[model samples]
Target: MVKTKIAVLVSGGGTNLQALLDAQREGVLTDGEIVLVISSNDSAYALTRAAQAGVPAVVCSRKALGSQAAFEAAISQALSDHGVELLVLAGFMSILSADFTSRWPRRILNVHPSLIPAFCGKGFYGLKVHQAALDYGVKVTGATVHFVNEVPDGGEILLQKAVEIQPGDTPETLQRRVMEQAEWKLLPQATQMISEEIRREKDQ
Candidate 1:
């Protein structure tokens, strides 16, 4: 069985990346192997995590590039150079261009901190999603793994798991719970689903 080559894009600490790495090591990712880790920020600790795991890491700093197009091009080139079959956005902050999304379509996946459509869309990301959910007083908040499209968080949902919002739950606390319970679990499961589907298709 051929394993699909996956490239993870990150901007910060890469907790999600770590989860995927752990899953891959445990053989949970199933027919998908994380081949490369790319970061939009040079100082992102995600690169360090990838290096520690003995995975190739690359930096395509958005700040260093003159334009958004250039930055997108660099990312695209990196994916192509690595022969990535799937792209996973793990705490990656940069908004990819429509051209890039169109090129990849459902081949790209992202794990958002909220169930989406409630604490999602433009201007809602990272802790902001949890903050908005907390401000809205939602009793249940969770994570979502969805295919990447042109619109932000506007894609076909693959998996979602709700995390109960306890009393006195701050955004930080809620974020931690969601990451531990939902994001970590759902991302790997969703990736495995895609990988298995690809394998089945190839077999047929």
Candidate 2:
């Protein structure tokens, strides 16, 4: 099927990564095979998930590597080793430089926990995004899957699903809701969409 070789970059609990694994198990992710997982933290739970799924995983800790450049270099080398064709940032914490993004162009994807252009960009991640949405009194918050570019969260969006903000929603509650209703579903869908695109391009 010429499935796209995918590498998931993660930094913490890999709920999103687990979603991709589950999608593959159920045949929802037909055009993409998750070949590797690269984690920025050595102790991240995502590694355990990857091990259980039998996916090869590696860690390139920013602190242990001692610099962002070295950390990225390690990740680049691993991706090269695996011949990864697509990169997915699933709760990945590092900010990739322009040099790195340029190397992959539209081949990188990120799932941000917001509708984007809303509670995104610098200082917007994890629970902070949901807190910002609640602070602004927004009735709806969601997730956005986009192509990663130089700017933070400033990439061409691929998909988004609006999750309603409840009356008594806290940041934790809202974050969970967004993941349940949006991130998990959209990440796999966007992955398949891009995987199919890559397969077609490769065929031609």
Candidate 3:
């Protein structure tokens, strides 16, 4: 079977990207190969992670591009050039425009720190989502993997795993637990599922 070419977009530490890499190394991502890693920040550690994994990494700084259209165009061009069949927003901070999302359709996927329709959407990212969940005193909060649409975090849900909110859990500890128990497990599983589906479609 031909492996689906995957490109992961990141802007920060890229723990999720590392999870994918680890999964690939362990033969968990059987139907997909992480071909490229793109960073919106030039100095993002994700680029270093990609380098260590021998995956091609590119920096297309949104600030340097100065316009959403130009940045999206550059990203689209990169995806095209690399023959990327699937796009994963691992820790990508920039919000993609409708033009970009529409161009790829359901080919893009994202992993949110919380269940969608809760601590998601605009202004909720990274630690903010976990902070909101803890502030709200929710007994349960976890990770979600979904298809990326135009709206932020407003995508078709694929997989979600709930983590029990401990009594003494702070945002930091909760975030770490969620990444370990949920994001790391779900992202790779969802990616493999999507890759297998894409392979089946091609075979048909």
Candidate 3 deviates by what RMSD? 0.7
* Residue lDDT tens for model 2, 1-204: 789999999999999999999999999999999999999989999999999999999999989999989989999999999999999999999999999999998999999999988999988999999999999999999999999999999999999999999999999999999999999999999999999999999999
TM-score of 1: 0.97
Give the higher-TM-score candidate: 2 or 3. Answer: 2
How much is 70 displaced in model 1, in angstroms?
Answer: 1.0
Q: Residue-pair clashes per candidate, as listed?
A: 0, 0, 0
Of 2 and 3, the candidate ahead on lDDT is 2
Best by TM-score: 2
lDDT by residue (tens digit), candidate 3, 94-154 = 9998878888777899999998878999999988999999999889999999999889999
Worst 10 residues of 1 by lDDT: 194-203
Candidate 2 backbone collisions, by pair: none
Report clash pairs, candidate 1. none
Give each model a TM-score: 0.97, 0.99, 0.98
TM-score, predicted candidate 2 vs. hidden true structure: 0.99
> For residue 45, what is the lDDT in candidate 1?
91
